[model samples]
Target: MNRSNGGAPHRSITAGTDFLHLAIEEAPGGGKSDWLASRIRLALADGRLPMGSRLPATRVLAGELGVSRGVVTEAYQRLIEDGHLAGRGRNGTIVVGAPAAAPKSPARTAPPLPRSVFAAAPGTDVFDTMRTARARIDLSPGLPDLAAFPRAAWLRTERHVLDHLAASDLGYGDPRGTPALRRAIANWIARNRGIRADPDEVLIVAGTAQTLTLLGRVLRDDGITAVAVEDPGSLGARQHLHNCRLATPPVAVDSEGIRVDELRATGEAAVLLTPAHQFPTGVVLRGSRRSELTRWAREGGGLIIEDDYDAEHRYDRTPVPALRSVLTENVAYAGSVSKLLAPALRIGWVLAPPRYRDALVDAKRFTDLGNAALPQLVLAHFMESGAMERQLRHLRRHHRHRRDAMIKAIGTHLPSAIVHGAAAGLHLTITFDAEFADTELAAMALARDVKVHPLSWHSQRAHRPGLVLGYAASTPSDIGEGVETLGEVLRRGGAGPGFVR
Candidate 1:
């Protein structure tokens, strides 16, 4: 058989007699395994079975062909050795990497909520739409352990806040978020991030999205319309900037961090960055990049809108100092308890340069009259009572376990793939070498009920295909199973590595 070039046509048999016609009978216990392997090779070559087509289990096919299980096993082993088939954990044996044009048998489709679902409208409720999209399994990123949310602790705090709540306290509180929360956040940042800020500079807003919206409006009003962003950055952040009618100029990011020279070249008045640990790539903005960016900020008369997202989950490296701590005036620093505590709290802090502080506070004042008061106060109590820090410690241990599991699973199943950004944060970026689209692979994965963010979604420039998988919210077994399913999909030519689905 010519393995490199296309072979002859597949044998088209109607039913039982056809399989029997191709089947070789064991004679005097001669080499059944070698015979079976030869038959399989011919079948694969002639297109009798296609790529991604699931083979019958070893014992079942052995019984049907009236052969010993070892004969079937040996045949499978030979094909596996030749890179035609793979053992897909619980997914069973599947043909993975086959020639795109050389195929025969058809297969079932993913249940529903197809890949088109991700392209839905980007409005106020887009996130809700995404969360509700049904899949066989959900691997959406940026979620904490919803199952581990401190229900008892929350109830106790809620009751305490309500008991102490006077009728007047329920009315409109400070537009700069609740004083209690601002003070709490100030203290928290001082202790954890090494940034000391007057509570006056800390304006509470609704998570990072609102922080972007408010900043976008305030910056635009200040005659700054474009903000440079890191290449292969957060898709959600880019969308938020676009939603506020702001241009996001793309800046290249390298090993150290966002290219400061490129940022200066763009001449954009402001830039948004995830410098602590960059989004998909996971590289921290090291000393050189930090110093370069600081100098650029001082020289360019620009602003750095820092999205200090998920800075608390470092494993292999020491925690890097926040940009706000380094150049407080130039960096409009924002952070939330979303990754640390929960996103549902809808509470985040922003430290703006003195020039934009009043306008940002005004935007917050008009934007839903500031974030709700009770959650802010309860979070304050949580921070003061040490529950927040305790929760972070708990998440660190849990997330570390999941991250290790995912790395191990990738090593075993998809050894060809390179893993990035596994040291910190809840997700890891995995890239592979193939001509096929990653989006198509993601679509196939979705069809199989596994959801992953296509790396293309985060990149504005041409780049390699990959997936950003979050490990924080899921259990270790779930992470392994999800990645295994992805491996099976890749092998089957449902989608090739490096191609966007």
Candidate 2:
């Protein structure tokens, strides 16, 4: 085993070193040490002898190389003197540093989304692009006070859950949701939104976006080809419906909420609405409008997909009950923690009409098996412990401060801007009675390191130029600065009459 070569004539010995099979050779001259040092240098340059790699013992290498210990020791000393290796006494000789590397070309990276993306109605990548855009302050709507996530309470609940969880609980959960979360949601909505639902009736989904998708599929299969949507409604929601191959017909929404007569005129048997607090506009469905809608639904055998988003964040308005509270048979209600906690937790609940509950559950079963079960348990625990209620209270006070700051700033800065949906929700939409392009203003704001959404992106018909700004995610100072900047931009580029209402 010790004899490496055939030993027929003679061969220069090569070391069986542990340094990735490094070998040693003595040439015609006394050059073994030089070859050893050169190899070590090359390995260091190539990162094989990275910093902290311990070299093999000198005695072992010398024996393997059939060279004197002095040769190995001399080579190690040369590396140490050159500052590439260091001796650690009994530990071993270790690589200390490496040779300077040559400069390399910069790596390729994707270009930023063109500002033209915001010039028209937003596409699938619009939200992603806006999120990734570099901004000093982001006032784009549809986010809550993410900085106030109850991490401490969540950890406490998580630990408690883990300690009590059975092996089966960690396995694939029912698509309808864990009994624990469904029960918690049943209790939650009943208590908060005045809607009572059985635990089995609540189908857990991956937030409102997925809820829309699943509903679209079931509704289409039910021979409902078209679902009427509120004009100037959520562009994201409209996109979700359109993606599922459903025709989204627009109905006009005035200050009080959706015009039921116009909705009746659309001839659509199904409709999607944000009645608790309308998206972007924040108008609660009027008492008369709600009654009229329920009457229409009962008469036409229609379905209402109620997006009960951000209704819990009310500051100055009387709490409007969710449509599902009264119109249980016709309304399919959806709500999520995206606005309450964070969008990162893609967890939401959908309570369908009895006729479609089973079908929706099956779609959810095949969609992703189910939302990760552990988060559902954590949320259930969080809700039962009253942490969610406390969080809402905290968010209301915090968001109200930012909202007040924004209103004051707008009044002082852009006095001609009409602020809509200020009494509730995380954001306020302001429309300017001007002819300039809101999309151009949004692009200009992004260029100045501020991010905001143009209102035209959410509208299907001609309307005054507007902007939807979120204050809940930012500090009062940021809100003020952002509104002031908007005013400045407007002043520089076709300053329209600004009125703060």
Candidate 3:
């Protein structure tokens, strides 16, 4: 049995002493310490240094390798200094969590399992499984600053709301959410998003996901089979629409924004858009395009589903008012606190056109009977008390700094890349003019343990090779490290060519 003294494996002397199986080279005469460090780094890069894995003591490893203890000590010290390893008092040296391990090619004894969205007896937890799939560092878009969640403020609000509520109020409130939340939402839209809405016009639902689901049901019932979506737009949104059985026609988006000309050509009854800050590409609808789209909505009698996502988190530009604020009758407007607050809250309000208001409320009533009452009351308190606005002010400063860090890192690491939509929002879309497939690159990135959304993943129509990276949830250091790792991945010609499975 090996007596692990915390640094190295206390096994019998073998021909190999490192992860790369680097045999001692007598011809080189020295530099074993450097070789040891390199081997450890490679092991880490390839995921051999899994989280919480104990390392053999320096003395034990030195004895096994027939080398001095100083060599192993120096090598281990380097990793410790680099945040890759941590020393546990009596427990010894341990590998802390890092990126995921690269996939190893399947051998004859172990064939790789096939992956698909639809398989018989599908995995019980698809969402959790997808999240667990390897990535070196995740650059996925849309995540907010999770670490900065206003826990204290939320607790205070919860306590305040609970204190005032009577026991009778707990026994199932209105299905359209608490009337208080609807009134507060009305005030919120009028103040922040520029939409002058009445409390009765507001129908509270879960987040935008439920909004799309209900809208899908209502539109389908009304015989509207297709809703045109911006090309290279939100994949999650498109998938949600598809899940609701609504056919999504891919419409092209240019610098000014989604091609209204192409949209008109489709002759669809309705269109879903991220007009304030378009997703994935980050291009705002220009003056001309906005006018043209409004004209199309007016003349063609097509309804517009304006998802004013990420409109409140702007920096370096004046706020753009929601299109619904301009033409309330033609637009079905929706906004959620998912990005602003937390998606876990599942609290948002929708303002449908007069014709669809009652239908949407009915749809919401039948399907979950309104969001939780207490939470809605608390949220109402949050908005009416102006706590939500203060929180936004705090996030703006924090998010701006994080965004700048990511941009600077990209400049320093991947100079060939172009950043999109840095003027506002919690994430940035970066594209590279490389001679490689974004999907393969994304898979390779995942193989290397960094998570990112391939630009192609969002595109129904063709788009350039790129990745959508979210900086809001990560520290500046993590963003820099993640981008640097991505640069290394690119420099190495995809994700470590031969080592990946």
Q: What is the lDDT of residue 309 in candidate 2?
A: 78
lDDT of 3 by residue, 429-464 (tens): 989776566655555555545677777768876677
Model 3 spans > 4 angstroms off: 1-136, 494-501
lDDT of 2 by residue, 175-276 (tens): 888999999999999999999888988999999999999999998898988889998899889889988999889998998899999998989999999998
lDDT winner, 1 or 2: 2
- Evaluation by lDDT, superior candidate among 1 and 3: 3
lDDT of 3 at 6: 32
Task: Tell me how candidate 3 scores on lDDT.
Answer: 0.78
Give the lDDT ranking, best first: 2, 3, 1
Residue pairs in clash, model 2 = 15-24, 415-498, 415-499, 416-498, 416-499, 417-498, 417-499
Query: How do the residues 1-501 of candidate 1 rate in per-residue lDDT, one tens digit apiece?
Result: 112113232222224215534455543367877777666656666666676556677877777777778878987886664446666555556664332233244453424454544444434465435545555446666877665576657777878888887897789888998888889999999998999899888999888888999999998888888889999898889889998889888998888899998998997889999998899889899898888888988987779999997788888876788999979879999998888777887778899998899999888888788778888888899898888888888778768877898899899878888999887998898887765566667777877667888777678887787888887766555677789999988788733333334
C-alpha RMSD of each candidate structure in angstroms: 14.1, 17.5, 10.0
Error of 2 at 350 (Å): 0.4
